[model samples]
Target: MSALWTIFRRDLTLLLFGAPGRGGALLPLLFFLAVAMLYPFAVGPDAKLLARTGAGVIWVAALLAAILPLDRLVEPDLEAGFFDQWALRGIAEEGVLSLRILAHWLSFGVPLMLAAPLAAGLLNLDGAQLWTVELGLLLGTPGLAAIGVTIAALTAGLRAGAALGGLLAIPLAVPLLIFGAGSLQPGGEGGLLLLAASSLAALAIAPFAAGGAIRAGRE
Candidate 1:
């Protein structure tokens, strides 16, 4: 319990309270906010058009925005030899990884998810559809965060990590994005059910997979 809180608070402080001056963190959050706003600008100015594109725009932006921070996900620990130190501490590596992921999700995922409703307004979502978009995103984004952290962890120690992280994550995330975005279609309630299920499943499975990947990297 204490360890979990310790890791969570440490990452949360870095993610939410860090000075904007730091390049290792905080920059990606700013990017998230900026990308979320671009949809209404590039798509169209009309409210209907904006609403039409709003869910997808915000969804895609949120995915991309959160992912941007993932590149540094484990690179710092690996570079600083903190990974080695942790491994030597007789701690279960999975707990460390899970707590770190939870922290990262809290710092990155929770905020973006919270901000989605407001971004929906920017996208001009109708009141009714706004609720739908919120439902879809809320249920679907944990899957995204899980898959993202898994893939990011896989690629974080590699050379050309940014490009490789994109390569690995883009394909995996497509399904969630599809059904999640599809949920916004008129009479598209089917996709919402699937996306919601996917979210739960991913939450169940992806963390273990991410833990496996992290453990494998150390071997």
Candidate 2:
């Protein structure tokens, strides 16, 4: 228990503040905000269009932001032999991965939610729309975190793991994107339910799958 807490603390700090070569939480936050800021310009000053499509833009930005940290998620630790060290100390890879997922969410997911208001303003979303976007992100970003970690683990040993991880994550994340953005529509409250279900399913499956990937990498 103590070791896990320590591990969690270490992970949260590294992910939040970043390491020497890693960009950490700030990269995703800035990227998300940048997308929001630039989107209005790209499409011109069409207020109606911005309001109508803003939520979906936010969802897309969040998805891209989630991808930014994938290379750092597992590869750094795996390359440093941290997984083997934890295993030698009787820690299960699944357990480490589970905590890592939580830590990863805290690092990027929570910040994105907090920053959503600012993003909403930039994209011209209304109060109600902003609320829905927040809720959708709350339910959806965990799934993104799980997917990111899983993909990171799977591709950690590959030559172009970072690029491949991004490709893999985008397709897998389509359901979340659909349901998340769909929730912004008038009759789309049900999308929130599906979003939560997808997030939970990913949360449930990611640890074991990522753990197995780690073990496979060792062999």
Candidate 3:
């Protein structure tokens, strides 16, 4: 229990504050905001158009933002032998990975939600649209986080793993994107339920999948 707490705290700090070569939490937030800011200009100043497309744009931005930290999520620690050390101490990779999913979500998911209001304004989303977008992000980002960690673990030992991880994550994330954006439409509340289910499913599978990948990497 104590070791798990320590691992969680360490991961949270590294993910939130970043290390010398890593971009940390700030990078994703900036990228997400940049997408929001540039989108208005790219699509012109038609308020209705912005409002109409803004929620989907936000969902896309959040998805991309979730991708930014994938390279650092598992590879760094794996390279540094932390996984081995934890194994020596009888720690299960699944438990560590589950905590890492939570930590990853905290590092980017929560921040995206917090920043959604600003993004909403930039994209000309009304209050009701903003609310739905926020709700969608809440239910969907965990799935993004889970997918991110799973990809990170799967590619941790590969050449150009980061690029490959991003490529893999996009297709896998389409379900979340579909449901997340779908939730913004009128009579689309069912999308939220689907989104939540997707997120929970990812959460359930990520730890075991990532753990197996890590174990395979060790052999």
Candidate 4:
């Protein structure tokens, strides 16, 4: 537990606060809000419409927001040779990626879930649907992080890699979003359960792929 927190704090501080001028701090948060806000405008001002759409809107926004930071993840650390030092610590690179992703989820995904109320308000989501949205996010965001991390590592070198990461992520994540968004609809609890199952499955599989990608990036 202490080791986990240490890794979490170290990765978080390095990515966010540890930078010289606080460069990346606001980018993730603003990206989150902006993506959430787009729904009402795009779908019109009808409350019912917003409520129905809000769940999907927020889920997609959360996903995009969650993914945005991943592009920068290994770039700086790899450039500075953190992985070289990390490699000698008797821990596999996958273990390192797992720690970092968990911390990133805590810093990024948890707040996205916490701020879901803003999306609810904007979209006028009812109580049950709001709960559905929340539950879906609770389960789904970790999947998003796991999958997003893998894709981020894969695209670490290309110029448009970050954008491509998001693109690749969308297809892989479509099912989660479908179930997550559907969960907010009437009689959609089944979908949330499916979403939870899906997320768990993703978590199980994604790390190995991400670990492989990270190793390739290192070499």
Candidate 5:
């Protein structure tokens, strides 16, 4: 219990504030904002068009922001022999990764949810649409975090793993993107339900898959 708590705290700190060679929540937050800010300039000042497309834009920005932290998630720890140390101490990799998924969501997902309102405004979303966007993100970001950690573990020791992680994650996250953005539509409650199901499925599988990847990498 103590060791898991310690590791959780460590992962959360590294993810939120960053380490020497790793990115933190700030970079993703800034990148998300940048995309939201730039969209208006690119498409010109059409409020209806912005409002119509804004929720989807927010979904896309959140997805991209989720990717920014992939390089730092598991690779840095693997390179530092942190996983080996945990294994030597009799801590299960699955346990550690389960905690890591929580930490990753806290660092990556929550901030994106918090920032969604600002993105909503930039994209000219209405009050109702903003509410829906928030709800969709709440359900969807967990899956994004799970997928990010899983891919990070899978591609940890590979060449250009960061880029590969992005490629892998984008395809896997497509369901979340589709459902998340689709939920913003007026009769889209079904999309939200599907989004929740996808998130739960990812969360259920991520810990075991990521643990196996880490163990394989050590062999």
Candidate 6:
């Protein structure tokens, strides 16, 4: 229990503070804001259009933001011999990866949720839309985080793994995007339920998938 707590704290620190060649929590948040800030200019600042389409845009931006840290997630620890050390100490890959998932969600998902309101304002979303958007994100970002880590694990040792990770994560994330953005529409609360289902599915599978990848990489 103590060891797990320690690893979780360590993983959280690495995810938040970041090591060399890895992005910390701030980069994704900034990237998310940048996309939101730029969309208005790209679409000519039409308020009604922005309000109508903005939730979807936020969903896209959030998806992209979630991708930003993929490269940093697993490779750094793999390269630094941390995973090896954990193995030597009898720690299971699943345990480490599970902790990592929690840390990643904290660093990635929570902050994005925190910044959603600002994003809502930038896109001129109304109160109801903002509430739905936040709710959608609350349910969906965990799936995004899970998918990101799973893809990161799968592509960790590859050349241009970050790019590959993004490619891999995007398609898998379509369900979340669909449901998350869908939730902002009129009579779209059902999307939130579907989004939660997707999140639970991802969270359930990620640890095992990522653990397998890490274990396979050991050979």
> Which runs of model 2 end up more than 4 angstroms from their true locations?
none
Cα lDDT of model 1 by residue, 1-219, tens digit:
775577667766765665443343455556666776776667668887777777787778767875776666666666777766766776665676666666666766677766767776777777788788778777876777777778777886789987888778877788888898898898888999999888778677766787777778878
| Clashing residue pairs, backbone N/CA/C < 3 A, model 6 | none
Q: Per-prediction TM-score, please?
A: 0.86, 0.99, 0.99, 0.88, 0.98, 0.97
Give the distance in Å from residue 161's predicted Cα in candidate 5 to where it truly belongs.
0.6
Clashes of 3: 0
Q: In what order do the candidates fall by TM-score, top score first? A: 3, 2, 5, 6, 4, 1
lDDT score for residue 8 of model 4: 62
Off by over 4 Å in 6: none
- The lDDT for every candidate, in the order shown, is 0.72, 0.96, 0.96, 0.76, 0.93, 0.92
TM-score of candidate 6 to 2 decimals: 0.97
What tens-digit string does per-residue lDDT give for candidate 6 at 1-219? 688899999889888988777768999999999999999999988999999999999999999999989988898889889889989999998888888888999998999989999999999999889889888888899899899889999999899998889999999999999999988888888999999999999999999999999999989
Worst 10 contiguous positions by lDDT, candidate 4: 17-26
**What is the C-alpha RMSD, rounded to one decimal, of candidate 6?**
1.0
lDDT of 4 by residue, 45-154 (tens): 88877766777788778777876776677666666677767677756778778877786677677777778887788778887777777888898888887777778768
- In candidate 6, position 196 carries an lDDT of 99
Error of 5 at 2 (Å): 1.0
- Return whichever of 1 and 6 wins on TM-score: 6
TM-score-wise, the better of 3 and 6 is 3
